[model samples]
Target: MAVVLLLVSPASQALDKARMDAAVKAHLALFSTDDIVEERFAQRASAVDLDGDGVEEILFMATARCVGANFDCPNELVVLAATAGAPGQAGKRLEPDVLAAAQTGYGLAGSEQIPGEVQAVRVLKGTIEIAFLAQQDSPVCKRSFSTDQGRQATTHCPAPGRHTWTYRWSRGKLTKVSS
Candidate 1:
């Protein structure tokens, strides 16, 4: 098993809870309740300099839960860039084409090209790394087979591996560097 460590950049340290709360408040209508927004923020939000600017921007990996999950749930990469106002003001939404591309998945190891679920995102050395869980079509053995001596044969399902997509930030844009 491979483990990827998440390292927070110095810029991210500037991101405080007050600013995050304000950002969530600005988009409250998107979620069902305040709790969902808080849950997503606590779990998936990351702060990094998406643009070349020195200030850090909030990159929230919002899931379908943000809205009512009545149908297919799609993940969204929400970017909140700092607005010129109060010192602790929330940022304005900045949607770039690269953000959509970041969500797109390349094929996993020894498998067909399938969309992997976004698991984590982090900023490291001026690049963005997004981790995904690659889904595999493995068989699930519900019932155990009887052995020669009446011993039960237990079966287990394989765990999904993490697939990472690396993106480089340049000239106020994100370009896929590797998968």
Candidate 2:
């Protein structure tokens, strides 16, 4: 009689807590975990010396499944940055007005096509910048809604292909930055 033996190896993983937290914050900003039926997602980061401080800044990308009624939305991309000591703790969320300004500049409102994921985030001159892509390839539609207080603004995109969106908070208000 003859016997055979096989060995398996576990997948390799990176140990970067700061990068992970930035990705998670981005995810929470985009998609609320309050809903049922969890979605699959992934995030990665690349370190670069943006400044001459000899410290490496992180540029991260996050992708996740969209939460929709029919499950027909596209993936999301988010780009963000965090300091070296503690991840995400140093970065400030974007304000609704700031997001509105950016969206207005991009001409994305009232059912525009926006990127589904956050592709990158960076810190520059003590400020945080976030970059993202839209879902629709054609003319994208973007819109914004305002409340009575004028302190909060909600942005929306109506891209049929993509299923994810992004949010930014600043000064204690949350606004939809991209979708």
Candidate 3:
């Protein structure tokens, strides 16, 4: 009897850096120079499949400063995922959607602040589970009486902190599985 050996390389299963850069660039279009965004190798894209479609998704973090000192602002670490698609662009060149994005921002007021620091991603029992710590704000409501309005309500500030969350892929996006 003869014994045969097979060799497998780990780097072969890794993600392409060029593709990751393209996906990150596409996502950066959503923010302007005034915003604070972190787009780099936060984690390995090959670690987990974000969309459960056999293809991998890239995850990154971003931040935006919308409020001033008086506003009830919370520091957020935005967790973003990019999927494979031809999402649609208005540029002179062709840009493919290589990630999944949701509820980031559009340079407007009263937008949702979802920032998560990606800790780890694990594929358990064929289910992709992502672990992260995101921002969560709880408003401190205050009530006051006024002559003109009789009663008024005001939200002074929101206590935001990094909360642990477990998210999964659903419908081409990362949905909160548990927090």
Q: Name the best candidate (by TM-score).
A: 1
Question: By lDDT, is 2 or 3 better?
Answer: 3
> What tens-digit string does per-residue lDDT give for candidate 2 at 1-179?
89988553322223256644544444434544435324535455554433434333333443334333223233333333232232222366666544432322111111112344445554544233455544442222323324575544224545444344444433322245543
Tell me, what's the RMSD of every candidate? Answer: 15.3, 15.0, 9.2
- Candidate 1: which stretches are off by over 4 Å? 1-13, 28-42, 66-72, 85-114, 136-161
Q: How close is candidate 1 to the true structure, as a TM-score?
A: 0.47
TM-scores for the candidates: 0.47, 0.30, 0.43
Candidate 3 C-alpha lDDT tens digits along 104-178:
211111112333444665655434454444334321111232457575645432234444545555554445556
Ranking by TM-score: 1, 3, 2
User: Whose lDDT is greatest here?
Assistant: 1
What clash pairs does model 1 have? none
* lDDT value, candidate 2, whole model: 0.38
lDDT of 1 by residue, 1-179 (tens): 99999787854446666666556444423333443322322236655666656677666654533333222233445555554433321464434432232222110011011135666777887777777774453121112344577746443322456778777665545567887
Once model 1 is optimally superposed onto the true structure by TM-score, how far is the C-alpha of residue 69 displaced, in angstroms? 8.9
lDDT at 158, model 3: 28
